[model samples]
Target chain A: MARLREGLRVQLNVIQALTSRELMTRFGRENIGFLWIMVEPLLFAALVGIAWSFIRGPVNDEINVFAFVVTGYIPLTFLRHSFGRSAKIFVANSALLYHRQVKVLDFIFVRVLIESVGAMMAYMFAGIVLAFFGLFPFPADIGVLVLGWAIYIFFVLSLCTILAPVSEVSDVVEKLVPVSIYVSIPFSGVFNMASWLSPELREILMWSPLVSGMELMRYGLFGSAVTPYYDLGKAFGVSIVCLLIGLILCRRIRRTMTVT
Target chain B: MIETRNLHMDYRSGHVTKHVLKGVDFTIKPRDRIGLLGRNGAGKSTLIRLIGGVEMPTKGKVIRRMTCSWPLGFSGGFQGSLTGYDNARFISRIYDKNYSEMKEFVEEFTELGSNLKMPVKIYSSGMRARLAFALSLAIEFECYLIDEVIMVGDKSFQDKCKEEFFEKRPDRALLLASHSLETVQQYCNRAIVLKDGRATTYEDVSEAVAVYKKL
Candidate 1:
């Protein structure tokens, strides 16, 4: 028991250290440095929200296009960014493995953390900005929003866990990750509500943890005004399975990887 | 104490599988200065990497009972875009050492001065080596894994390194891998000669050097 506690403490220290390094290396010490973490995502979501609002002009009178885009894009950004970063993460940070205290999982964990935190901040910032303009409504169900976001974050982390290790072993997986994200965008439930889908399509889309998560998020934001179709149990179950598979694959890769 | 049990490592490039360490076994006790000797591609560095816990063996395990430093002169660990000070700070935090103290020690030791503020990638190879060596010394691990090419900069800098590793930390375990017999003879009491994916340890340094010369 004592040894386990000590191990956990050491792992935490390594994670903290790597987090600081990731921030510095990525953001640098220039103008507003780490602030860009929040700003970069916010700008991406804001631009997309405006463009999306203009592109799908007045489609649904009940829904605020700006709020819809902000809510959906924030989580989508987290997923896409996490996946994009996970590719070749292990290989890129191979130097860090030289330290006995640092593990391959630590690299993935740090990236996931950075993306999640950034996306969360962007979510709050966008909500505040839109609410100030009287365009975005305050979340009707903050509890549901938080819960849905947490589940989505878990799903992204699990997906990263799998990708980080697989990318280390295969160059093909690394090369295909970005393209895969673009292809999956439509089915990711970013632009359309689950209720808007036909019954046949909704059944297939509901199988996706991403769709379920987005549905829950929209339900939380728009409340009774929007109809949401999601099975929380199915989403949770799929996330758990993915998490287990990710952990197993990561463990196996750590055992065999040559940190050169 | 650090011990390796039947450690085997195989590297695969395309269709070729190079068996680096084939069931090699050894133990390193406290205060034991062992020299690792081998020809090029003889798995000398691979053995050090395995002992340092940087790489996993293909078919065995390394049991480490004490803290071990990474290969002392390896600059690959530093992020290229970050300044030298940032790299030192990162290492200090990870090792749970005093950040200000580590920075001071590295600054004094490396004497990089204004250069410390520049990105590490902009620094010369010698500068990177100096920073790595200084940071390793500041952390003060129980054992140090030194590669063959750690002797960087001029004679004064090399002397400083020797002083830091030998005079200052005499009781710490040293696993030095080098092709130079003189260095091994001067610093190590025991020697391990690696060949054909196996390692043979000799208590007498001269005898090990003699055997290594034959290979």
Candidate 2:
């Protein structure tokens, strides 16, 4: 018990160091610095929301287009950014492995935390701005929204964990990840509602952990105006499976692989 | 104490497999200053890296009971965009050392002055090496694994490094890999000659240096 506590303390220290290093390296010392973390995603979501407002007319009669876009794009941004960068993290931060305290999992954890926090702040910031203009309403189920976001974060983290080690072992997987993410967007349910699809298609889509998360999030955000379809059991099961696989793969790679 | 048992490392590049360390066994105890000597591809650095826990061997295990520092003088650890101060703080935090003390030590040792506030990418290779060396010393590890001779800056800087590693920290263990027999003779009391993925330790530094010269 004492040893476990010590180990946790060491890991926490390492995680703090890694997160700070990541922040400094990414944002630099210049104007605004780490604030860019919040700004970059905000700008991306805002631009997409404005463009969709003009093009798509209204995503739903009761739901505001800006709110829908913010909800969809912000979470997708978190997932995409985290997963997109996961493959390259080992190679990019391989130098840090020199310190025995620093582990591969620490890198993934830091990245996930950064992306999640950034996305959450961006979502809230956009929601506030839209509410000020009377274009968006306060979420109907904040508790459910928070829970859904937590599940989505869990799924993203597990996916990233699986991808990080796989990418280290195979160059092909690294090359294909970005393209795969782009291709997987429609299936991710970021732009479309699950209720819009036929029962058969919706059943198939809900099996995807990301789609389930999106549906659950929209359910929490939009409430009774739209029916959200998701299987919480399936989503949780998928996330756990991915997490276990990722942990095993990462351990095997760390044990057998040499950092060049 | 740190020990490697029958350690074997092999690098696979496509169809080719290059054996780096084969059945190399050694132990590093407290206050033992050992020199590792080998040819260009004799796996001296590889042996140091394995001992440091930065890389895993293909066949055997590295048993580290005490904390060991990474291969010093390797400048790849620093993030290019972060200022020198940020790197120092990061290292301190990771090692659970006092950040202010580390920063002060690095600033004083490297004599980087205003340049310490600038991004490390802007510094010269020599400046980077100085910062790396200073940070390594600040951590105060039980055993230091040095890749080669950590030559940095001018004559005064070299003297300072020698003083810090040798004069001040005489009791600290060192496992240094270098081709220069003179450097090994100066700093190391014992030596190990690595050839064809094997290690032969000599109690007398001159004897190992002589064996290395013959190889």
Candidate 3:
């Protein structure tokens, strides 16, 4: 157990180094090196909100579309980035993996850590910017808001790590990445609430852990009495299972990786 | 000490598998300057890759006492799209070392002038070689697995490398895989001749050269 703990600590250090390198290379020596990390996702959410506003009229009458989009968009963006980035990390950086110290899990952890932290900062920035513009809506229950974010991050990390090797081995998954986003549109519950759906559809959609997360987040943000039939316990369970599966795949594939 | 016990490696491209290394047993002791000599298809580079931990053996083990460094090709451990400086930063990050500390040394050794700011893909092969050689030397490692010639760089840079890397870093062990027998005689005291995925060590460098030449 002590040896495992020490090994994990060392892996964490490697993740930290890779994260720092990604941050530096992505932003460069510019003054706004890291601030852009916050700005990029916030702007993406804003653009999406603006585009959605054109079709949906005025977003939510009681709840501003900006805030609604942020709660949904920020978390979803983290999920997509984590899954997308982590899946291809081994193949993309095979050169670095040649070194014995640089493990496959270390690469996945670095990317997930970067995307997760970047998304978190983007959320905070979105909140601050919305508040400044009088477009902010405070969560009705802060506990649920924090819990939703935690669950979303956990699930995204697991999903990405599990899918990464599969994506690398087959070009089909890589091509379907964008297609998956379009498919996930309705299931993610980004545009609607669980309470608004028919009970059957809602129950089925609630099976999607992301939908449950989004619905719970809305309950916290809107302060409305919404008793979601979605299981938070299942969401946590699936996240752990996905993570373990990902870890197993990574261990099996590490030796087969060859830098092109 | 770095050693491979009955190492076997087979590579599969499509339908057929090429048996690259067939039960090769060799050991590299601490501070053992060994030269690897073989023809193109003699599994010389493959053996180095196995020892460097770049490729896993099919049915054996590569035991290592400490971390080993490998300079496999011209642009080793570098992203061509990134600038020279960015690549340096990436190396330091991967190794868990300080980047700023090696900045001056890299700048002096590479002597790439203003080209350091440009993407490495834009640089000439010699320039790329210089960058890789410099980066390898920048990081201190106990053992080095060098493939091919280091003389691909300019004359002055090559001389500087010998002075600093070969003469200065005496405690560092080297496993040089090269076709040049003269280079092997100059740099390596011991020789390992690999044929049909097996290694036969020679105490006399002349004997190893003769064996390789006959093949």
Candidate 4:
């Protein structure tokens, strides 16, 4: 018990150190600084919301366009931002690993954490702001929304852990990430709703853990305005599988790392 | 003491692989001042890194009961955008030391002056070395690993380094890896000569230096 407590203390200290370093290097003390994380997502969501409102018009009177877009786009943005940093995390922080207390897990987890909080703040603040303009309604079930967001974060983080180490060994993974990020926009469960599709199409999309999480989040917001198709069992199962695989992969990365 | 057994490190680039350390076994006892001698690619640095736990060995174990400092004067640990003081604070956080105390030591040791407030990328190489030296020393350790740290800066700076490290820490253990045989002979009581992916220990520093010169 004493050993576990000491280990936790060291881990917490290392986490704080790495987290501050990451934040300082990324945002610096310029105009707005770290506020960029929250603001950037809002901008992305708002821009897409406006575009969709212009192109498709109002699909249903019960649903707000901005709320629909915010729910999807902000979550997608979180994944993009998190995975984007995960790719070259080793190269950037490898020097700090010289400190025996600093581990590969610290770097991977800290980046995900910063991005996760940023997305959460952006999602909450966006809803309030959009509601003021009558563009979005307050979530009917904040509890469910939070739960869905947490699960999505878990799923994305597991993927990030895999990407962080995989990108180190494979040039193909590096090339694939950027292309996949762009390609995933439509299928990201952002602009598209699972309930809007045919049974076969919805079943195919439901195969994606991201889509499942997205539908859950959408249902939490839209309530009776739209139907949400998701299986919590499936989302949790796939995420656990990915998390285990990612951890196993990250553990093996030490063997492949350059000695000096 | 920090002990290692059958340590091996291999570097892979493209289709080729070069073995750096093979079955190298050694222990860093408390207060042991050891000089590491080897050729340019002799894995002197690699051995230090493995011992320091920066990188894991391919087929061995490193059991460090004693805390070890990072390769002294390694400037790579600093984030380019952060000021010298910020980096120091970050280090203090990682080591669970007091930030104010680390800053105080850094200000006195680095002599970076106002440069401590500026981004590290703008500083000269000498300034960085000084900052690295200050930060490393601020965090006390059982063992200090030096990898040709004296090669940087001018002669006076080198003298200051020798004084701060060799003179100040008389009882602290040190593993100094350098090409300068004079420095090694003067400070280290023992030596480890690395060659062909293996280590040979010498009780007499002069003997290891003699063997190192022939290699």
Candidate 5:
């Protein structure tokens, strides 16, 4: 518990540095500095929606294709970027790590918070723009939607912390990032609801916490029926386990990993 | 009250382990100023690092009954992109202290003037050395581990350093590691000369200088 308290304090300091640097370096010395945070990600979502228009039919049948893509793209963007950067954090901020008060977990937590917050803000902006154009109705349940996003963010943060060190040592894991994205693209549970999966298939897929998180999110926000295997118990279990494993991995490699 | 018992450090590079500190022991008491003198690669810097908790020993323990500052130098610690003022804030936060007082002191002492607001990477070596020295002195550690920091700066700042270090912080114990004979003799009472990773204690400052000179 004492360690936890200390970790929280260190995390606060890390966040201060991370946010200051991110805001300063990214926005630069321009007048429309802060506005770019929302604009950039929404632009990417727009581009993807446009590209998908030509590749196939609609991106989703249940909702406006753009809205569906925006919903899925926002969280995943945060997940991917956080994981990618967090993996190399120890190397990137060696100076900060050498200080006694700065911990390995603090660095990872700061990166996760910054990326997740930025992505969420961008998603909110996109939602407002789409609403103005009458592209989709306001979300059915704002509370559930927010909760689902929070849970998904938590799971991804834990997973990235665990995978970061492993990815650093092996170029194989780095190369596999996009490949994993491509493979998981079909199973993202965005286009197809988990309710449609066969009982056996649902049971097997629930083993993947990412899929479980997405399925649970869909149910919470859209009142979509989840497969019989959609267990909040399982999602919570996997999240807890992954977080513990990640913490252990972080502790062991804290000293060995070179700060960049 | 600081001591290391049977401390051993091995710097491993792929296939070989080069022992920097091969089973050494030493003790430092309150207000006891000690100078560590040795030739290049004699593990002088390594010893200071181990004592400061920057690096852990492969075997044995560093019993620190008080806080110890890391070796004073403009090295791989400060963020190059941050201004000296911002860096000072970070250093204070990490040390769990107030930055306002130290920031003012460092600003006045470093004499970098407008350069304090500029990124640290843009500062000259002498300016960096001054900043490093000022940062170390700003943090009120129970024991300071000085490494090759006293040799820098003009005669006036050097005198300022001595007055502040000796007169103001007389109660603070110091472990100064340097090759400069004058610094070792003037700043420290007891001296430890490291040779091939082994530390030998000298009763008089002059005796340690003789050993250091021969090396």
Candidate 6:
């Protein structure tokens, strides 16, 4: 028990150190460095929000189509940002492995954390801004909304974990991940809710943890205003399985990889 | 003490698998200044890397009871975009050492002056070596693994290093790998020579140096 606690402490120490170093490397100490994490997603959300508002003009007073798009868009933007950053991560930071204590998982986790936190901030900030303009409504239940976001973030992180290490070895994988991210965007339930689809289509789509996670978050935002179709057990089960496989891959790579 | 239990490491490049360390075993107790003498590609650095837990041995285990420093004078671990100070700060953070204290030592030891503020990628090889050496010394590792090419820079810098590192840390265990026989003889009380993926330790440094000369 004591050893486990000590190990956790050490791991946390390494992560904290890497986090600051990575921040400096990516953003630097210059003007609005870290804030850019939020901007990429915010810009995408803003553009989509505008397009949707123009097209639909809000079906009813209760459903703010712009708010719907922003909420859905933020997670998609996060997924895109994460996959974009995953390709060169291991090779670029392979040098840091010389420290012996800094694990490859720490590098993956730090980026996930940066993107997740950034996306969350952008979500709330976009909501506040859009609400100010009377184009959005606040989350009806913050707790459920956050729970849904956490599960979605976990799902995305699991996918990233699998992709990050694989990309390190295969150039083919590196090229394919970014393109796949764009191709999979529409299918991830970012633009439309599950209710918009027929029951058979919804059942098929919910098999994807990403789509199911999207429904849960949207449900949190709209409350009784919209019906959410998601299998909590299925979504969580898939994420946990992916997460396990990803962790095993991470460990396998550490031993097999040479610190060049 | 640090002990290796029949450690074996194989490196694969395409279809070729190079057997680096084959069932090599040794134990390093406190204050043992053991020089690692091997020709180029004789697996001196590879052994050091395994001992430091930077890489895994294919078929055996390394049991380290004492803290070991990463191969000293190695700059590959540094993030190139960070300044020298930031690099040092990163090490301090990982090791949980005091940053300001490490900063003072680095500034004084490296003598890179304002160059420490510049991104490490811009620094010359010599400047990088100084920062790397300084960062390693800042942490209090009981055992240190020195890479062969660490004897860099001018006479004064070398003298400062010997005075600060060698003379100061009398009781610390050291595994120094150098091509220079004189360096191996002067600093080490004993030595280990490598050949054909096997290691043979010599109780006398001169004997090890003599054996290394023939190989």
lDDT of 1 by residue, B148-188 (tens): 75654677787887899889888899898988798899889
Per-residue CA lDDT of model 6 for B1-215, tens digit only, reads: 99999999999878999999999999999999999999999999899888987788998999989999887654567888889888888899888899999999999988999999999889877787778778778887899888864576667777876776678988889999889888888888889999999999999999898889998
> Which candidate's TM-score is highest?
6
lDDT of 3 by residue, A135-161 (tens): 776668888877777777777778777
Compared with the true structure, the alpha-carbon lDDT of candidate 1 equals 0.85
Model 4 shows how many backbone clashes? 0
Runs of candidate 3 with Cα error greater than 4 angstroms are: A1-9, A29-61, A225-229, B98-100
Q: State each model's TM-score restricted to chain B.
A: 0.95, 0.95, 0.94, 0.94, 0.95, 0.96
Error of 4 at A189 (Å): 2.0
lDDT of 6: 0.83
TM-score of chain A of each: 0.92, 0.92, 0.87, 0.93, 0.82, 0.93
CAPRI tier of model 5 = acceptable
lDDT of each: 0.85, 0.84, 0.77, 0.83, 0.75, 0.83
Q: State TM-scores per candidate.
A: 0.94, 0.94, 0.88, 0.94, 0.89, 0.95
What clash pairs does model 4 have? none
B16-71 per-residue lDDT for model 3 (tens digits):
99888889887787778899988898887778778878777778899999568865
**Could you give candidate 5's per-residue lDDT for residues A152-234 as a string of tens digits?**
78887888778776665666877777677667755556455566777787776676666666665555544542332356666
Q: Could you tell me how far off, in angstroms, the CA of residue A13 lies in candidate 4 after the best superposition? A: 1.4
Cα displacement (Å) at residue B161, model 1: 2.5
lDDT of 2 by residue, B54-118 (tens): 88889999998877888775555677778899889988898899999998899899998999989
The interface root-mean-square deviations, each candidate in sequence, come to 1.4, 1.6, 2.4, 2.0, 3.1, 1.2
Worst 10 residues of 1 chain A by lDDT: A33-42
Q: B54, model 1: CA deviation in Å?
A: 0.8
Candidate 5: true interface contacts recovered: 0.23
TM-score of structure candidate 2: 0.94
DockQ value of candidate 5: 0.43
